[model samples]
Target: MTTHIPAAAKIVADLKARFFPTPTYRQLQLEFDLLLEQRRANLRQGRQQEVRGLLVVAPSGAGKTTLVARVLRQHPSGLRMLTEGEERADIVSMVVPSPATPKGVGLDMLEALGYPLRRDRSAHIIWQLVKTQFAQRQVLFLHLDEAQDFSRHNNHNDRHAVISTLKSLTQSPQWPVGLILSGTPELLDLVNMDAQLARRLKPVEHRPLKTSVDGGMITAALRQYAAAADITLDDALCKPRFVHRLVHAADYCFGILVEMICEAIGEVLLAGEDILSTKSFVTCFSRRSGCPEGLNPFVVEDFLALDVRRLLQPEPGPGNQGRPR
Candidate 1:
């Protein structure tokens, strides 16, 4: 972070300052740290037996993607992704999931696990490759994010095929170490649609934050986000509406909130402000909203279009459908 710079260095720094001020090495943000810890502890303790796995569903603004990205980054098991890499003999996260064609999706997973889908190979070949290569790679987990899109199939057969493949994965040779599926409530319902899939997944559903959670704990998370962006809410800013808005912003899935706050805070700074103002606070709602500069009016429009009640929709499944004990 040296400020002094040579002429050539100055240009590079200026470009970076203007375009990529924030480092791009994606990592878990502060907001979703708590939820990440809870999940990691669950996986580590092998206490996954309580439910088949976990299901994290929230409204549009809930920040589920950020949390998933963090777990992908920090999960000790290795962040498996679909993109091809060289040193990928061990960590294999197959991004072979599409609501369109179940077989194609499965093939994508095969490719991610280091299985070469021999040029012009048959679908069966791909499926077999996925099975064997995954075993060879000894992947410990299969986390399918944005799973709600799985319903994008053309026919009932494809859906069943997708469900069957998922079920088989859970009962794999590796004892199906862990299955973490995340998406909106509709995704949870997709699992429910297939009784067998629902039985196998044992989803871990996420709950919304109460009006107040751990009083100081939730506030502490808010403080961390504020600190990250070099912005702090003043005592005067703690009026009922302001406090409620701040809390609500922080309430969504923590990991996402962190990503969102980073961008939102960037807006506050770019505006040449010393501290975040109420107008700034309301304007910077989400990372998407803070795109191309200030909050995009459309993000607010999409959110406003949907009733906020989706944020607090009761768990839609028999699993933990009742109040938490």
Candidate 2:
């Protein structure tokens, strides 16, 4: 059996080989940098205040998760950060549920922190265990990715509880835990729903990168990243041409430069005789699933719709009114 390699895939493989860990887009650099510092300091510190959480809102693929992973791995001390299995995680990270509610968010938090969750364990019991271990360890950093998923199908009351719980995690200065929350801007409205949660989270707001309009620091950063990656796409990620496509693709938020360029490279490779030109790259990237060009827009729309459903996860009926019922 022969494994056929497309031209685009070959180009992307070449690009990835050159830039294994591609630089993140410029817009998120500063915040991400600060986040790195916060994580480092949180390690081995007994009573230091953790950096406040970041509430980054952008399209789906803006490199947010990759950024967090990069920061954790790149640290000099190299303290181990593992996913939750059973035991508590002193310093752990994971994505929050869409339509974030106390229950959903709490479950994710529990799982992320490595709590031995069971139907048998009461919420009170779980809280005690988590709080005790965290306080003892002095774990100041808690990174929550895809937090926009915390949207609750229920009422304001549920949202408030979830917010309060997060706040409680940071209440004791002796055992304070700074959070990092990244997701879509709709989370802003979700925050508004729960005044106290909004008040406490004080989310360090973030917007998507722009390659065309802004050209000072952020633009320069993208150019630098492109240079590092040895990529000469007509528009840097900081430019409008690239950013616009990302926004439409709905991956402009948590997705990373590495993923985009690599995907584009794959697209270019799959383009038969087309060389690895930027046109081929972007044209291929414009479409999802590697289909023809015309179908790109609709595919993106379908994905966005899926994202909404996944994010909102509204409770059964009534919320949907009578149309479907």
Candidate 3:
């Protein structure tokens, strides 16, 4: 006999396929495409000039990593032969280790490029290998995700090592690969270390939205996601009050907000409901936060007076710990 699946689980399974692109996501996508195209042009021109790099900074949970990954998906990494009859990477991306040291970062890059390592080499040795391998691959572009780790808990010398290495990679008579540095705001410290480094990279900041300014956009995003999931949202739950509360609850993070909405939708699906109501959201928040109804912003009528931070994840620190790829 076949086991019956719960309606909620079935609906949530269907919702898994949905990808709601908010206004911010759209803007970032465009910027990334333009940057990628510009780099491609440089490759075509065979120009050895110093191709400018991009640094994207955002708070933890602001979706900096996800945004970059989505954009990079359009340019899949593979081997391509240069005019010089040498194999080169179309694009190479990797996450910088926590409290990233120059040597550790170098090894990470080598690993990302599919190089075998015995872990017996020094930072200097690993870097030499990296330069050689990168040259062989003719890597046109390199993306360092969670790059804030470069400066996180690092001494001045360590920080400088990482920065100088990055600079050398983009300088003339070397690889001259276009760089993409993405991480939390702490990444600015790494960029600001060298005035020249700051000048070389363009900054793309992702700041949290204020409810008063972004309420309409947030509301639209919520409605759009519900519609995509083939469900209706309650009119009350779609109002600015709910939107503001959500923004606050999510620490004004777009990524967190999207996840919270998806979780709420899942809750609604589990209940076999056709409409996303505040009650469903209340359940979602309560479950995520492990808070009673009185403290849950989605459950209480006077949610505006409640401090949602108490119920959310602990604030991010300089470490900004994330999964390693």
Candidate 4:
């Protein structure tokens, strides 16, 4: 016996490969290009440059990591440095550890650079290794995501120490690595404290869409994605009520908005439906958010001013064991 697959399912699979590069993605790409050019010039000239860092700042789900990672792919590493005559990385990327400290950050970088640390050592020793390995590998660019985590557990003095470590990497006379730091807005605190650090790093900010500012863009994108999936765009989905509700449900996050749309589309495909409907979205929202039908924005009437925070709260359920407050 042969199993049948729905046409909508095939379309959904095709849609998975689609990437709609928004204005923010383009802007970030342009910034990365300029920075790469400067780094190239420095490598060719054999000198450290004044502007050696770039920071991409955005909220939790503004797609900072996705955008930066995509840009990083465009600049593949593992090239030989002309002066050093060794295998060198054009760009190396890693995430800042949660509850970050100077030492943890060093280990993260060392690991990303493929260094082994079998023995226990001090932060100073690890960091020394990091700088030495960076020079040896001829790494010209370093990209750190979730950079705000660096400030999570740091006090004033500790924060300054972390900042100093970052500054020194770019200040190296030999093999100065251009830094790309991407994180939430709080990452700005790392630079604001030091005037020189602030001056050396350029900032690229990404923000979410608001009903007033990005309503048209959001609507157009939704329609485009629907058409690509060979599904009819639900009229309710195009209305202001549903659009803003989606924005709110996604915490005003662009990445999450995309996710919500994709998940809803997937649900329609699974249901073997030809038209995307508010009911499909309602089911998706309830399943993901754990909100009841009355509170589900997709289903509820007079949901204009509904606060979505309740959906984000953890409630006891089949998979979760109750804990005393």
TM-score of each candidate? 0.62, 0.63, 0.83, 0.83
lDDT values, one for every candidate: 0.50, 0.52, 0.74, 0.75
Question: What does candidate 3's lDDT look like per residue over 101-147, in tens digits?
Answer: 88877877777667767777898889888878876777776889988
Write the candidate numbers in order of decreasing lDDT. Answer: 4, 3, 2, 1
**What residue runs in model 3 are displaced by over 4 Å at the alpha carbon?**
1-17, 75-88, 300-325
| Candidate 2 lDDT | 0.52
Lowest-scoring 10 consecutive residues by lDDT in candidate 1? Answer: 19-28
Better of 2 and 3 by lDDT: 3
**Residue-level lDDT tens digits of model 4 in 1-325:** 0122455456656675566687788887888788778777766887666446888888877788888877777545433332223356666787888778888778766766667675477877887888888878777778888988877679898899888888888887665677888999888887788887788788876776787777787888789888877789878788887888888777687877887787788788777676877877788788787867666667656554455545554543565422221
Error of 2 at 17 (Å): 8.9
Q: Count the backbone clashes (under 3 Å) in each candidate.
A: 10, 32, 3, 0
For each of the candidates, the C-alpha root-mean-square deviation to the true structure, in angstroms, is 10.9, 8.4, 6.5, 5.3
Regions more than 4 Å wrong, model 1: 1-52, 76-91, 94-99, 118-124, 173-177, 214-218, 247-260, 285-325
Instruction: Pick the lDDT winner.
Output: 4
Clashes of 3: 3
